[model samples]
Every structure is written in C-alpha cells, then in structure tokens.
Target: MPSKSSARLAALTVAAVCSAASTVVIASPAHADAVRIHDIQGSTRISPYAGQQVTDVAGIVTGVRTYGSSRGFWIQDPSADADPATSEGIFVFTGSTPKVAVGDSVTVSGTVSEYVPGGTSSGNQALTEITRPTITVVSSGNAVPAATVIDARSVPNAYAPAGDPAAKGSINGLTLRPTKYALDYYESLEGMNVQVANTRVVGATDPYTELWVTVKPRENASRHGGAVYGSYASQNTGRLQIQSLGKASDFPDANVGDVLTGTTTGPLDYTQFGGYTLVARELGTLEQGGLERETTRKQRRGELAVATYNVENLDPADGTFDEHAAAIVHNLQSPDILSLEEIQDNNGTKNDGTVGADQTMSKLIDAIVAAGGPRYDWRSVDPVDGEDGGQPGGNIRNVFLFNPQRVSFTDRPGGDATTATGVTKVRGKAALTVSPGRIDPTNAAWEDSRKPLVGEFVFRGRTVFVIANHFASKGGDQSLHAQYQPPTRSSETQRHLQATAVNTFVKQILDTQKNADVVTLGDINDFEFSDTVEILEGDGALWSAIKSLPRSERYSYVYQGNSQTLDQILISPSIRRGCDFEYDSVHINAEFHDQISDHDPQVLRFHP
Candidate 1:
C-alpha cells in the first residue's frame, strides 16, 4: 500500500495531467535498475534522458513544493559526481503533495520530461522534471546533500554565451559551462539546494511573494542601496530571485537597498515569472536600511519647475486618482508645468469612439485641487482611435498641465491631431507655427505609438519648448531568463526610428535659434546608455540632464534586479551652456512595492 503522502501526490498528479496539455507523452516504465539523478539531469539545459522511462532514481528529498500548479519535490544525490557542470539534483513533478518528506531516501520509477512552465508561448527554457512517478521510500530521515554556496565570487562575471540561432543555438542548446557564464552557472545548480547570504535587495518585495537580491553590490550602487540600471551590457551577474515557501505573512516587505542577512537556504527552481529562483524554506532576516520615501522637491523664485510623470495608464474609472494627485502636489512640489503620459480617454478602457480625455483630465485636476494643489490648465492632441498603441480604446496620449499663475501656454492656431508642427524663424527667434502641436503623427516610426506632443510655454517672460513623449515600450523583447545568450532586442528597432524623428525635429528648432530652450522629457522607455538615447543625444544637440547627477542617483525605474533610468529629460545646448539647471528624481514610487506608478517622476528646475 502507498503511504498517505504518496497517494495524495498521485491523485493530484493525475488531475494536473488531465488539465495541462503536456507536450511530452509518457513512455512505458523501464526495468527497476538504479539511475543516478545526475544521469537524468544531464549537463545541458535539455535533459539527455528526457521522454525516456527511468526506474529507481535514488536520492534524498531536499525540498518539496506542496502547493501551486507545478507541485513537486527536489531530490539531490548524497554523493555528487565529479563533473561540476552536471547538476546532482532534479525535480519530480508529482503535481501534488508527493508523499515524501525532506531527508527521506527515495527511489522511484517515472518518465523523464522537459516541462516548460506556462507552455511554449512564454519563451522560457524547459525545466527537466520526472513525471508519472512511482515512489518507493527506501528509508526515512536520510541526510540531505550539503548546499552549494552562491555568492559574487561563485557566479561567473559573464552574462550569456554568444548567439547562434541556426541550430537552435548558443546557451539554449550548449552544454553547461558553469565557470564561463552566469546563465550556465545557474543552470548547473538547477534543483540543487543552495544558500545566499549577506545580499542587498535589488527589487522590492512584490505582490507575488517574491523579491530580488544581488550577492555583491552592482556597478553604480545607489547610496540608498539599489543597483543602478545601465544597459543590457551590464547583465546584473550576481542577481537572484527569492521566494518564501512559508506563509505570505512570514515574508518581509523590504525595499531596494535593504539587506537580507544570515542565510536563506532553498532549492533553486526555474520559475515562470522570474528565471532562476531560490524557493527558500528558511529565509534570512530582512535588515532595514533606513530607506525612507523622498518628499516633494522645493520650488524657488525665478525658477521654472517642470516635471514628467507616467501615470501608468490613468483613466476616469481608475481608483488611484487621489494617490497620484497627492504625489504630484505633495511629492513633486506642484511644478509650474507638468507633462503627463498614459492619460486614457474619458470612458477609461471603454472601446467606444471616444478619443477625448477631457473627462479623465478633469477628474485628475479635480482630485489635485481637492488635495490642495493649484488649479491648472491642460493641453493635448488626441491620437486617432486605436492607432496609438496601449490599452485598446484607451487612446493614451501625452498631455500638459500648467499653473496659469506661473506659466502660460503660447497658443498659435491650426494645431490638430494629424497636423505635424513646423518650426519657423520668427524675428531672430525659434518659434512653433502652432503651440501644443503633434510632431509627425503620420510617421511610420510612430505607428501604433504615442506621437510627441510639443508645447511652447511662456515662463517668466521666456519661451520654453517642452515635448511630452511616451515612446514605444520594450514589449515582445527577449527576457533576461531567455534560452538565448544576450537575447535579441527586436523591440528597439521602432524606438530607434522614433528617436531619430524626434532628434530631427529638435535639430530644426536649433537651426532656427541656437539659444532656443528646448526640453524633451517623458518616458523614453530605454536606458540612458541605450542606442535609442544616443540617437536623441546626437552631435551634442541635446543633453540627458539625468547624467548630470551622480551615477548612483540616476535611476527612475526598477525591473528584475536592475535599477535603471527609463524616464529622462533631455535639454538643448542652450540650457546646458547656462549650467544653472537643478534636477530631482523623486523616489516615491519605483523603489517601493506599493507604488502608484512603476516609474519615478523627474523634475527639472531652471531659471530661463
């Protein structure tokens, strides 16, 4: 008779198999000959013994995932082989509580399979698992294998292998080279018990009961303790994901820069959301770093404070108006001019013909006023229905809100959604033919993307051209956890073109007036060192103001384990020459899990 745990595991496995259309078909059971776990796991990403029947795979259960869709327990051979590239542990996908406790010496008969979590569409590497298992508990309370220590020195400095797509190439198909690349190092230890100690939190504690940490301080580590995000070139080599196997309440709410001290011991599991994760049974204590939320920036006389904020797809139906308004008023210090992105149409996500965001903007303005913010005037040119890429029918576009008492919109006539704004030389000064106009709305580069909204504002009797933009997002790009080394970035092609178009427009303004105060600001959706940003900063026509800050303080967003800048403010040579500008990236959002927007808003205060 099967043990109670084994029976429960079998019952759950059957139900899961019925629901999940598993790609690998189960094969007939092989003879009951003992097979080492390493032989089944192999030295590569794909198991050499995948889809083959294996019997009596002996090992001690190191960890068990009793809940979730991919329910399974990890088992590690007590005596690991000499090959460092081959993992000694493997996961048995029982799909339920496998009637095996940790430290039990078990031998099982099952079909080996390569299971891709979330299926093939996710583009993730297939995890080797033993399915349709028959378990035999040889003995109880066996000693588990010692955990492999994972720290900065243990992980390789390299990120990925060179790409070769013709043969399904590179890191995806090659044998594990644990000492050569970070991906390979993680792969070699898959399903093995591992330990991470004295690491800094890179990503905040997320809603999915997980956080990210780096074993060593990354390049340009923030004073507050977050790793500054640069380009894909700096592939955060020492970062790892942490998932608490205990109750959700037991998990700590840690922010970026906080430390995870002591030791977190767990089985390294490849997950669907993040790539390699330490599913920790025993998590270390979270040591707070005294990282407090930043307050609003201060405004000064003779200084025009301008800000750019991505509201994360705000609409009338959304309930975050109060929080967002408070952030703008109290945290941002009520700038003279504000550039807002992702403002949806009036009906919010409703797919009707309504492309106007008047209602949405009105609601936000009302909330701002209620929050003791100034009464502000707004301007924007709505995009064609369904043409702008975002939430379908949301018709998201950029808009400006200016305090009339401090700044006034320089309105000329004939500006509309389809009309491209033109630069004109007016009386020895650069001037827009129409203030608050769309720039090249019909450009192929801007197809299904937000067109730049250029507005000419008069602040303290001087003209400042502010272009609000929300560039093409980095969607459909290869994930860092992808099978390919240094994964292809197909999403950057359109952004490169978009950057060129905007740069050309800025050039036109500079050609007319060398001293023109042109400020381009919004979510560029790329890092400061990215090719897209380099195109915008071509020939020193414009300068990325964020670079003026210390390297440690340049980030406005955090993704995966990287603290990077996605929001930027680029100023013309005229503004750079004065050298009187002050910039602040208010850190109320990006570093915190309970954030209104995934991005932090940036403000530039300068005397014109």
Candidate 2:
C-alpha cells in the first residue's frame, strides 16, 4: 500500500514545475507580426497559426515552469479578446529553463506548434504551444491575470459535441461551443489560468504527483465521493486532473473522498494520460476523508465463494505479495476459488525464456497461508514464453487458486499453453478435456493476448466449471477525450473476437451438460454495457453478474474519476436461474491512494 498507479499518466505534467527567468532579444523575420495570445490558440482545438513564426506575442507570465524537458512559462493576455471561444493564454516551450518571472510582460517569438502528448498514436488531443522561442520582457511587476473560477456553474453538463465527419469524426477542427459542451468549455480555456475552489477529490493521488477532482460534486456522484461513468453520454464533465508545480515528494497523498480545502489555482493544460490537467502553481490543503478499505463478508456454510483479482502484472520482483495475500485473505475472505490475473513467470520479467510461474505461484501461496488464510493449491497453463503480451519479458497469465479443504480440482492432463481444451461428457456430466487448460489458445483471437484458462472443480460433490480470462487490453484505442468525438475503439475488435471465442466454448460446455455450473470471470477490459459484454451474453449463454448490482455499484475499476466496470463475473443459465448468488466488487484497492493493484477484486458466492 505504498505505491500508487502512475496510471499511465506519468506524462500528465512531467515538466510542469520549476523556476528561473531572463530576457531575450531576437532577430525578427518579416513574417513575425505582433499578435494576441488568442491568435495562437484559435477557436478550434488546433491552432490556425501552426508552423508560422509570430513575434511580439505579449502576455503577463502567469506561471513559470522550469521542470522536466518541456520547460517553459504560461502567459495570459490581460487585455482579453471579445471571443469567448478563443483562449487568452498559451504555453511557451523553452527546451531549457526560462529566463523570466511571473507578472513579466514577455513577448515570445517562436514557431506556433501543436504538440500531441504521447505522440500522434496516443489519441491525446494536441496541445497548442510556442516552441523554440525568443523571449522579450515588455515590462516587469505587472499583475497576473485573474484565474477564471471553474465550479459546477462554469462547466456545461453536456460532455462534447459530435466530431466533424470530414475529419473522420475528429473534433479538433470543429469550432468551440464553450457554453454548451464541457469538452469545448475546457478547450476554450486551454492554457488559460483557471481555478477550482474547495473541490472534492474523486481520484486518489498517484506516484506522478497528480490527483483528480470534480467541480460538480453531485454529478452521478458515488456515495464514496468518486464520479460514476455510466455511459458515453455521462463522461462526468466535472472531473478534471490536478497536478502541481512542485516536487513529487511535497505533493499531497490523497485518497478518494478526500477534500482539497482551498482555491487550487493553475493553468489549464492538456496531458497525455488524463486529458485536461490543471498544472497548479499553488495547491490547496488536503483534508483526509478517513476512507478505509472494504472487506467482503465470508461465504455461508452452504455456499462457495469465488473471486477474480488482477494483481497488476505481479511478479517475484514486486514487494506486493504480502499486501496482495492480505487482500485475498482479509478483504476477500479467502474465496473458495480465486482466479488471479497477471501472474508473471518465475524470473519476473527477466526474459531468459522462462515460462513457468512455479516460483511466483508458490510465493503468493506462502504469503496467503502466512496471512491466516487456508493453504491453497493452484492450477495454470504455462503460456508459450512471451506469446502472452504484457510487460515485454513478463510471461503473465491467469492462475486459479482453490482451497483443497473446500473444493477439489479435477486435474485432467494434456493441458499446455498451445493446446485448446474441450468439453467432454463424463457419465452424463460436463468435464474439461484437460483441467486447468487453455481455451482456444491457438485461435488468432488470443494472439498477443492472455488466453482464457478453464478449469473443473468439485464443490460439495457437485461439478463446476470456471473460465478465467484477461482479454486484450484497450491499449490502441483512442482516449475518451481524444480529438475524435466518440473516440475510436480499435482495440475492441480483438476483445470482441475473444468474447465470441469464449462464448462458443461456454456453449460447448452447456451443450455437454445442460445444468453445468459455469462462472466466466476476469478483467474484461470493457464496460458492462459494451458490445463485448453483449457478445459474451449472446443468445443468453451467459449473464454478467455485475448487472445485478445497481448502476452506481457495478464498478470494479476507477480511471480518471469514473468508477467503472472493467472486471466482471458472468454465469451460465444454471447459476442465473437460481438468482440466489451474492456478488461483491470488493472496494479495497482502486479507491485508496496507496493501492496494491489498480483493480478491485470481485467476489461471487452461491451454492453449486
């Protein structure tokens, strides 16, 4: 519970903090015409003056940042233009520390550029900036522009407008509608000095010295203070990323539901990871929420408990085994059968071609028993070296740990990484051809992704089938706040194929035994209402147990500020017909700042 997820947002404002200042003299080209700050930041997401040189761009230095590689200062034109759509501030990127100070009226002569954070393929909206600048101090000691207050009243409830068709639904070229769409509202104020006052922290502070808060505290708000992302329409426009212009060690360690009690002021900057980020020059006080991890109730005597948890690429190298063991034992109540995703190889990402996870598996088992939990036996198919894609060298795959005291594993041999397991009738009962076997591992649907691990277990003298999956990640998809409105989900194509493959295999089992108890669960990497889930539930083969929870409580993951469903448990007709199962998306890790994993484990209990 010491490390927080940089959440791939390590680039949020990597270089947004630093200090120093000076003056500059430049040999002005004839094309370097004096212009206003808004001229550089046009009415659209992209700048009109891109690739052109501009001179005498006058503004008061609102924030001087000399941190990281992209060091520079944010300048705001005190004399505002009449257009509300045009931003009056912009970032002047100086590869080195800036020779200027706050309130200095500096004119930077540089090529107007659009720097897409995380590069062009990252799906991040481009940041309009002035790079390779020549700075001229017009004057010093001038008052900085007053920061525009951003609260519930300021942000529009609507998320965004549709992207232009000509640009393939990219909203970048579309004119800003600041009053109507929240995305447009934030875009209109890009690089401008903005402030959120006394806001509630909806996201925990990460290792990157960043946190998230919602200006509109009541917008589909969870009881725990996190925002709910129910659909595309409910993007939670009030949520904004907060990063500070200070050292990482000095940054506040905040948990979900904590309050930042004061005016947190900064320039509105777009980032690679979390979209709109406010790089704070001055931070507010962090008031602890007294938030604590949740523990799911133990399974009833007549019921069996099953759970799925993504250990976030766990390996022997990580120090989180004890913490993870504690979660599986104390928080999850040591479910009878637990499926763990991202169990790395023995060497823990040391790519000498080792695929076996015996060391990694044994370490976790030892820790679990030490944590006052039942001694468990595990089953997993060793993935073909690096065919399962995760961290390059980490041969991560799914593993099932079941208590021998509670349930017996039906171990059918011949299950290897490359072989696909089939369902066969064993005395009129459904049985896996190879227990702890891979499902369609050779199928192209699992290419470069973790294949589904299916196993047969006996609980209370009844046979049960479990399929643990870690589907293809959403790595290549366009971000929610991308230039394209309704950003493209190119990564979902693989997930769809994966779902169909799993669905077909589940059908095979149900075909063999009509009353088979099957629990299909893991990190789906898709939402509850998504097409992938629909495919998984095709022809009523399976029903997502997450839907059983109210919309607000269905989430097992929190990204940005949205409590969402990325992990789920689905059941076959037999389990669904009874409708007597208990499911809990245990809230232990995702909500806290110091988390063992980015995903919360989901538990399901029912009589088999």
Candidate 3:
C-alpha cells in the first residue's frame, strides 16, 4: 500500500488530471493567499486549513475544470523532500485575462476558500476568484497523464437477468443504485462535465472492449456521473451499443480514440440497461446547444388560440403528417397556443432516417407560416428515461408550441417543459407558466413528477389558469377484480387519481381567483358519466360545456363502434359565462371520415 503521503500526492494528481481544462487550481498552505502553482511530491503533509491568504509559489499544472461559472486549475509541489504533501491554487480570470489551458505552470496569489458543501467533514479546499489572486506564468509543459480511449456504448449484455428491461447494462466499474436506481456517488457532477473509463463488450468475446471516454453531463446523467477507477466493474446488457470507433463513415463518427468533453447541460438520468444522461449543449461539438435556437412569430387577436393534440406516435415514415400539413393550412383551426403529445426525439434518425420531432415541429411551423398563421415558438423538455416511468431513446414525449409574439417564454424547470409529479397519479404532463407580454419567468407551481401541465394564461382582462390534462386510461387490465389487487387500483384507479389531482389543483387555483375561468381539456380517457369525471367535477360544482347539451349528443369518442364522449372541455362556471365557445368535434386526424384518435379532438373559442 502507498504511504499516506503518497496517497495524498496521488489524489492531488487525480484532481488535476480530471480538471485538465479548467483555469483555477486547488490551494496549498505554503503561499496561503497568493494563487500559485505548487508541485508537492506527496499530498499527506497538506493541512485541512482553508480561507487563508497565499502568495508567490511555482509548480507544475496537473489538470483543469470549470467550477460553477468559474474555471479552476490544479497545481502540486515537485519536491519529494517536503515534510507533507500539498497542492496550490491557480485561478483564471476570463473577464480580464485569457483562460489558462492544461500544462501551463503559472504563479498566483489569492485567498483560499475551502469547498464545504452543506454538512461534510472533508478538509479539501476549492480555488475560486483569480482577480485578487494574481497569477503569472513560470513555465509550460506538454499535457500530462494522457487519456485512455474506450467505447462504452457498444458493449453487449453479459449479465442481464431474463425479462430484464432492454435498457439495463453495466460496465466494469459502473454500478447503479438498485433501490434508488441512480448513480449514488455522483450528485456533484449532475450539471457538469465528467470523464470515465469502462469496458466495452462487443461480441460474446472475453474481456470485452475497454476504453476511457468522457461523458457530457445531461439531464439524465448518472449521479457522480457513474463511478470509474475501481475493482468494481460494469455489466453490458447489450442495451449499451458502441462500435470499435471504426464505424465512423456510416454513423455520426465519434472516434474511439476521440476525447469526450462537454458541459453539464442537464441532470442525472437512469435507464434499465445502464445509466443514460443528456448533454443539452456540448462545449465543442457539431450539434448546437439547445438554448441557442431562437423562436420566431406573429401576434393576432387578444385571444390566443390554444390547441392540445396527441399527434398519435408521430413516425417519420408515416407521411400522414402531410394530412397534418394540410390541416395546418386549411382544415386545422389556428390557435395562439398549441401543446402536442407523443412527439418523438430521434437519435440519428431510427425512423426511416428522416427528420426528427425537433425538425418536425419546425416543418409544422413552416406549414403554419405558409398559411399566414403566427410563427410559433416551441420547446420540449428532454425527458430522461426512468424518471416517472420514461424510456430512453424511445423519444416519445409531450411538447408545447406557442406564439412567441403573444406569449413569451417564461420560467421553466430548465427553460423547457416541466414534468408533473403527484403522490396519487402516474402518467405525467408538462407544465408551462407564461405571464402576459413576456413577463419574467418564476416558478409558478410547486408539484413534482406525475402532476398536471399547469399553465397561467392571460386572456381578455383576466389571467386564466388553464390545466391541460391527458389522464390515465381504463385500458390494459380486463379482470374485474384487478382494481383491488395489490396496491395498484387497476386502470380505473389510475384515472381516478388523475381526476383527484386535477380537482385538487383546480380548487387551489380557484381559491385565489374566485371567478377564475379554469378549462380542463384533452383526451381524459374516461367518459362524462364515469365516476372519475364525477370526482373531478365535484357533484355539479364544476360544469362541462358538453353536459349543457343533450346526453346522447355529448359523446366525442367512438369506442367499440359506439360513440363515447371521452374527449371533453370541462370548465368552471366563471369561464363558461364569459363567452360562447363551440366544441369542434371535427374528424381532424380521422381517416376517411373515421375518427383519427381513439378519442376525438375538442376545441374551445373565447373572446380575449
């Protein structure tokens, strides 16, 4: 075993190598206030002291990384004769001076602020602020500790249990938390850059393929970004597929020897085969950052037409969207706001290798533009598989497309859609809150996954709080006693919980806006007569615009050849009294006059 001093030296080296690109360095006690590079042979002699001032020290640069908004670099003392091993800090000021790259030995002086999160006893100190901690170059050298190359995505499943999910996979040193289903050791790297080495299994071969690769932080990345450098290993369930870095011509061509580096644009996400995270924006990549795009538009009447449609598993090859294209031009009733469901995210085009949902929405926008409709700004909250029962690379999700001129983008979880969370409900909705005239974005609701898509809409003279819901369906199980089985209350129970949550949320909103006009619409999956609807409406306390008409004529869906009213536009009396809106139960996506969806599309028009 290495001595404590040697271990300290090794740890410092690891930190330096890991953060090779950052500009700031870890601080040492020698020149406390001055931000200088120190080359300590061993790190054990370093004391657990911080917040001190150090000045004037020279050493070798080990690694670099970006800390929060600031860039940080690491340095170490070169003398093996030192009593205790120690490392010094080197801060980079991007505002005034140029950023320091790897292998540059610079002397600096500044305050030492130790990194202590919440409640931990670690004595390690983090280097911050290079402005006061002046740094000057002493020497420069080639980048040290060359990175090992590896392809992790190509590994096949070596230890997958029968009937296990298709996404489950393991690497030589990667292990996901069984119960929590997360990367337990990676909370800090949730929205940051990370690099790791793991075995890549190709065929049924032994030892598989081993390579070191950098993983960009994504919304669905592993918590400590998936552990590396350990006796513990990863198991490939074949869910993680990568090539020998040889198949570059046909694919996007990330070379096996290519170093992976990007920013932590999203959060930690997990899947069944292995942990999967997203890189919303890559520091250096062919793909642009998700936040880089701009939304264009045109504003019309005060009333923004809001439309929610479940495009029904949009496939690139279906070509049925041409009909949808026609609808945007002629058949479709233009709305100021449109929320679509089941939009698919394509990873290099698996569907007939055509355009993706991101581009499809763009095409839809173009179609609307050709029809002289307002240019719509759209956003999709990249959903990581495993959060509230999502699938990785499966790509299907709900999206919000709106008129940028009428309603400006406001506060979102990450400037995108928000997944609703609830204790009782399951299938979630994406919530968006926009203040009239592009007001500042603030957190509008305080619910977790499985909640409703709560939207604060400003229409006419009042800010209407609208909740667009696509509730749980009573399909799947057919057994009569399934509702009472285990903790799950069958499919009926699922719909019931959705109703309850919508009711609870609507009531809360109504409490503040006594005359609040709350309209709940979409494919509710239950009929107007179902008990779920009853609980949602609260014994005639709520009113369905369709209920005001005759009973037989209220059906909007055709079930088993019978016209069942599944799609409904329910509202609070305050909203119903304001304007006369008609429910256009047209066969929009319907085939040859046949209903397109198992449920029909309902529309509501009100004066703004």
Candidate 4:
C-alpha cells in the first residue's frame, strides 16, 4: 500500500456478490447473554466494550477476505439498534484465512479490542475488532443486512470535530455526532456494508489496486475533477478510499475524472494508509473520461523556458526513458533549461561502488534527441556513494540539462561532491566560484538529503542562476486523518533548515548584484503554502511562481485524494518584478493511470 501524510491503507473488501438474505442473530443457548454490534461499538471513538469479553456476538457474514496478513470476515446485524452513532457491524480478525463464507450466520465470542493500524506511533485511529475469537456456525445461507447508501446528503459537511483541548485535540472521548461530522458519520458505519452510486474518482488507481472517490461531487473540486487540498482547515470530508477484495488482476485500470458507474458496495473499515475506506466486495463498472495529457505552448522568442521534473528515481534500467523524453519534447515543448531530480547513478541499484551517472544521463539525453528535443548537455556533481538518502545504492542527485543551442553553461573547474560552492564578484557581477557546484554541501541541513545543485547559465548574454533542489521527503509525517487534530509534519524540520540555507544563499547572490536573475526550482516535497516555501521567499528576496497560478490549477502532484503542489519554481526579485513570467504546472503525468512519474513537471517561461 502507498505510505501516507495528507500524503496516503490496509484492508480488503466485499460487495453484492458476497451478501445473501436479511437475517437476525439468535443468542447461543450455551451463553444466553448476547450483545448488538452497536452496543459493543458504543457512541465514542474507542469502543465502550474494549478489553471486555463479549458473549454470543451474533450476525450474518457480509464479506470474507481470503488474502493478505489480516485475513478476516465482516458480519452485520440485520436488526440494528436505533442509535445512529453506533455501528451495526464488526471485523473478526482471523490470523489465517477463515473458512467462513458470505451467507453464514455466525456467533463470535472474543475480547473487544481497539487495534490501531500502522501502530500507535502512527497517530492513526484504532479499529474496533473482535480478536482471538471462538466462532460458532449457527446456520448457513442467511442474508446479510442491506447496505447503507453513502451519498452527498448522507455525509456531513464538517470534516471532524475539534479534539478536546485538555487531551491535546484528540477526539477519542468525544461522542460521535454522525449527522454533523463526516468522520463521525464514517465511524458510525465502521465495518458495516455500505454503498456509493456513480461516484467520481479523485485519486487514480495505484499499483496496490486502490483508488479514492468523493461522496460530495463539488467539495474543493479542481478543474481536472480531483479534490484540491487548499488548506489545513478544508479537509475535503467526503473523500473515501476504495480497495478491492477481488483479485488485483481483475481490477479496472482507472484515471482521474473517471466514474465508478452504478453502485460500488463494500464494508466500511478504518485503515492505515487511508483513514476510512470501502473494502469493496463489488466494484462499480469503469466509465472512462479519456483524460489526455496536457501539453503547454512553446515559449515565445524572447522568453526562456526553464522546467523542473522528478523522473522518479529514473535509472538506465527503467523503460520510462522514451516516455519521459516524449513528455519533455511534446508536452513540455523542449525547454531551454531543465532541472531533473531523482536521477540515479550508472548501474542503477546494483551498489558495487559505482557513483558515476554517465550511462544514465546519456540514455535520457539520447532519448530526448531521438524524440526531436535538443541534444541536451547535463551537469551535476555525483554524490558521495550513499550519503544522499534515496534508494541506498541508487545515489540519486539533481542534474541540470541545458540546450547548448539556446543557453551556454559557465563551467569553472574545482567543483567536487563535498566542496561548498561560493559566490564571488567578478568585474562587478555575481559569479559562482565553480560553475556547476553543490551549495553548502557539508551543512547539517543536507546531512542525508540531496544538496542544492547551483549552476550558472548564460541566456542571451545574461547571467541567470538556476539552483536545482530535491529536498528531504515527507516520510515520517502523520496523516491528515491522524487521531490528533492538525497532525504534525515532522519531516518539515529538515526542509526548514534546508530552505533557510537556500534562502540565505540567494540573499548572498543578490547582495553581490541586486539585479541578478535566479531561478530556484525542484521537487520541494511540500505544499506551496507550507513553511518551507515561505522560508524560501524570505523578505521578498525570492518569490514562488507557483502562487501566480489560480488555486484550482496550482497542484503539480496528487497524494491520496488531494491535488496538491510539491514542485515549484521560485524567482529572484529581478524575474518576478518584471511581470513577464508565465508558470505552467504541466499535467502530463500525475493525473493519469499509466504515469511515468508521480510528479507532474512544472515549467516557467520568462524574459531574462
């Protein structure tokens, strides 16, 4: 499954194919005492019956998950209690695949436990399950409960209730108001059979055969029909993730803006990657929207187009070179300058002390040339073996690809992996001590991350400084659905220091020559509105071009269900003040099912 942060679940599903007739549970004669699923679930986030033993918890099997480590079955009571806040169904955690079938009427005896996905440290909400169960087959071929329809009207507008101030904003103890909050609504139907009709796909299906759809069609809807996560306050409450109980090979290949036609029925379950998800027993039919890749217009005669693309750990071994080249030639229109991130070394992941990327860079350049783009020349300092924190042996680093026909690179000697690049004044103009160099490479901020690659390029006899960066990723951050309100972004601390260092370096260049043109662009691994971007734009010394685009068109990457911004190009005062710049978040890759990279390349065109 995709690892998450507002970023990215476990669990399987069942549908109409698994469910049979409406039935009620009869208390076992052995243990006359029985409990409704709702009574065990209670009205709070944590189950009221937690750690306590429940006898004769009876219901009909609605779904059976026969694969994965957490193999289990879902059972729902047809005769549900009137309380809307409590669930009518529950998951029976069987370590191995249970022999139970969909229509079997079963009575379970086990300890009620709150099982947290991804562990307690993940800050995820716990799932109420019946673990270490002793199950009795009362009868066979009974019908399950009718699925609760989850439509726009049924889900509330509010994302979640505020965590109690005393308990540090945790809503665990708060009573669920299903009609008022979306999280509460999902909580009420946890493990219950549910369905959505004609839902819009917001997140494209990933390798794990999982996708996301929104119950509310218009909630923060983007131009491309995906949900736009504009701010922390607007959580897009209607978004629900979908994963199949069926075979992965049988799942439909879907893209953004596509439709899940008719009804998709599944058991609602809380998961790790995604918060609340529909484990689909029966998936809806795919209705293609035919989303085509977007191609930006070529730059004007006087405009210099500089683009940034994360080739997604590209190596010579991957077959995506042709596709990446085509996107650069046709979709990006062959820019004058290109900043490439995640470019792996030669021999790709074979370790063996091979730090050179000549073969890898050569293949991409050759492919670009074959695709009708210019025969681009590349410049980069190979990282010190495994210091850069990408795939261990991949030695991923940033590289600058410039069209020699359009731009000239000022190649000064003495630049190496660990040597810090310095700025100097040559004849009253800002000049790099080394043309293609690493900026403050040994600094603590870049300890295990890709260092900033600063290079000097002359476009039309004007010196333009372009710094390519691939900052620390958001690996350890908590998800948006974390139990704690306003989940913490722990990964931003390193990016903060890195941003400060880069911002300070930009100031040094500007201090030497106030009118110097600088373009700072790459995979920021953060949102446009994040503290990292703000730090990079300190005191108007630099300004991000991404903010120039409208809110709906601002995103260059999609995580989970949110169309968010991660790649950005920030310009110095000289470039932003002229009002001659145009920025495009080229949507060639991110919104497609068959994408070459997870990030969509961003292009900036301006007169230097």
lDDT of candidates 1 onward, in order: 0.84, 0.87, 0.39, 0.87
Worst 10 residues of 4 by lDDT: 15-24
lDDT of 4: 0.87
Q: How many steric clashes does model 3 contain?
A: 86
lDDT tens readout by residue for model 1, 1-608: 00122333443454335213544343544443577888877888887777777889988998988877777789888898999988988888886777989999998788788776545554667777888889999898877788999998989888878756775544656878899988889989998999999888989987767899998785457867877766677778888999977888899998998899999998998865678999997899999887777875578989999999999888999999999999989999899999999899998668988999999999999999999999989999978898888877789899999999899999988888889999998789999988889898899998989999999999888999999989998866667878765676778999999999999999999999888999999999988889999999899988889998887889998878788898999999888886899988889888987877888999999888
Q: List candidate 3 stretches off by more than 4 Å.
A: 1-304, 315-318, 347-357, 386-395, 405-451, 477-489, 539-542, 549-552, 590-598
Q: What's the TM-score of each model vs. the native?
A: 0.92, 0.95, 0.41, 0.94
TM-score of 3: 0.41
lDDT minimum window of 10 residues, candidate 1: 1-10
Candidate 2, residues 207-292, lDDT tens digits: the string is 67789999999898876888988887788999999998877788899998999999999899988678899999889999998888
> Which regions of candidate 4 fall more than 4 Å away from where they truly are?
1-33
Better of 1 and 4 by TM-score: 4
Looking at model 2, the pairs that clash are 21-99, 21-100, 22-99, 22-100
lDDT of 3 at 428: 35
Backbone collisions counted per model: 4, 4, 86, 10
Q: What is the C-alpha RMSD of each candidate to the true structure, in Å?
A: 5.9, 3.8, 20.8, 5.0
Pairs in clash, predicted candidate 1: 5-99, 6-99, 229-563, 296-331
- Let me know the TM-score candidate 4 reaches against the reference structure: 0.94
Please provide, for model 3 over 474-529, each residue's C-alpha lDDT reduced to its tens digit, 9 standing for 90 to 100.
43332111111111224566667667767765665565445666677666666676
TM-score ranking, best first: 2, 4, 1, 3
TM-score of 2: 0.95
